[model samples]
Target: MDDLLSGLRMPERVAPGALFLPGYAASIEREALRGIAAICALAPPHHLLTPGGRRLSVAMTGCGAFGWHSDRAGYRYVSRDPVSGRPWPAMPRSWRDLAREAAERAGYPGFEPQSCLVNRYDTGARMGLHRDCDEDDLTSPVVSVSFGVTAAFLFGGAERHDPVRKLAVESGDVLVWGGPSRLAYHGVAPLPRRTHSLTGPLRWNLTFRRVTHRQGP
Candidate 1:
């Protein structure tokens, strides 16, 4: 991992224990996209219903031992896809390696993620600011990888109403947050009308999390 980090550009510190690594995944773009395609083919992407019964703007799917899901019952992780009633596709090794590498580069080493939630955003799609506190462990950092299109990321304090710092993130960017900033509120702004050679009009975000400390999917 040290050798790989040496080839990438230096990461910018977003906050205490938070890092924004621009183009950090550029070298693995092809493998990452391929892995996403394979995972979605089996599980497919669908908008999830929030506890309020509102449909999410972003289409979501995932691979790994546990997949994040929500539908009126509140947010949680499941071992299978609710839509297909099948075990969520296995996370690709390449995806796992990339996530670990990114986390290590950001100073959060030993991030063994059990979930990789993939969000697909199109024009006008957005995710409201929220904290990732549903994980079984809070010590592990959240590593996010972006592919296709460009979006504004809202990084805020622990409180939802706190001031937010917006950052423009392009394809191949990777952001990791943990430690003091582990539960910080963050999200993506509505995407503008745009297209990328790899994802067309869609923006892909893969978030890796250590969902559970125990075994079994």
Candidate 2:
């Protein structure tokens, strides 16, 4: 069964109210990667330290009205960037379109996102199992899209100890979670290093959300 499942395509997301859709960006790989590159040019990915004073290995940057931050203080979203003191880059149309489309497919409508967290994963980068509890609005769904090399997506139950479903997230795949499954513990496993024509040596994930707090100028 393990072999059969592995051979299966990206599964239909089954997280109650959570929605997952895979987009084939193969037709526009160049544009998609270029959009990501442009965003990186605006705000390069950097290792961020958690409140526990531990620095994450993945290079990350955010583009949108609100960006997620984790530091000595804690993990939260802020308006202006602590580094540039300016607003984070805006979500590119491709990113926004993919997010909105995923949300709609997931049965959530009118999802206007104000934040797009872009994370870059190299060979060993992995985001441990965690719940997205920082958002003020739990009603809004979280939309995540994968591009470049494939990775294992860990989607667990509400509790930390519950069993999890491992899904293979490939480039152009979108996952949406909300309603009953909004807070399910989810994250990426260690990414195997591989080169792609577009993303080269890494995989990119764009997480879109409607942040609870409003951004300031």
Candidate 3:
């Protein structure tokens, strides 16, 4: 797959501090998917309740030291799986290396992500525009890797009412945003009923974040 990524073009700047990397994860897709499956085996994916009591359409799970969670209390990161009551599966080295390399390529170097929120979007599932503010280390970019079916990614400014740009994200694509765009509102549009050779009818996303200011580089 390294040969597959070699012919790709340079990263496209989507905003002041946001870059869209086409097929950035092509080389590691199989390993990443296997890692995600292993993580899910230990910590099953489930829809989380929003602070408003609404249930998210996307099923969520994670790996790494911290996993992003949402409940009646609100969105936050926890060291253990809320369901299994065990530590989230350790983040795979390939995942960490890919995230770090992607962030560095996007101009945010030394991004040591402590949380990797894995979201599974079945057909018709969609995420509302929102900022990732739970993490204290806002300087580190959010490195999002997409696999499986294609979906529309909505990237917006800081405010909820700001204009949004829709981008088609296919399997193996990566999007990194931070710096001025760290607080940008972003979400996934409703996934169309479709199939990918690798993931069948689902779209998988691995979102890497630096959850705290104290974590090492």
**Residue-level lDDT tens digits of model 1 in 1-217:** 8638443445788888899998988888878888889888998999999999999999999999889999999999999899999999998888899899999998988889899999999899999999999997888899999999989999998899989988778889999999999999999999999999998999999999998774534
Shift in Å, residue 186, candidate 1: 0.4
Which regions of candidate 2 deviate over 4 angstroms? 1-11, 24-28, 213-217
What is candidate 1's local distance difference test score? 0.90
TM-score ranking, best first: 3, 1, 2
| Runs off by more than 4 Å, candidate 3 | 1-10, 215-217
Top-scoring candidate (TM-score): 3
What tens-digit string does per-residue lDDT give for candidate 2 at 2-101?
6596655544856798755655444555676788898788788888899999989778888888888889999989876667888888878876776777
lDDT of 3 by residue, 154-197 (tens): 99998899999988888999999999999999999999999999
- Model 1 error, position 105 (Å): 1.4
- Which is superior by TM-score, 2 or 3? 3
Cand. 3 Cα-lDDT: 0.92
Candidate 3's displacement at residue 4, Å, is: 19
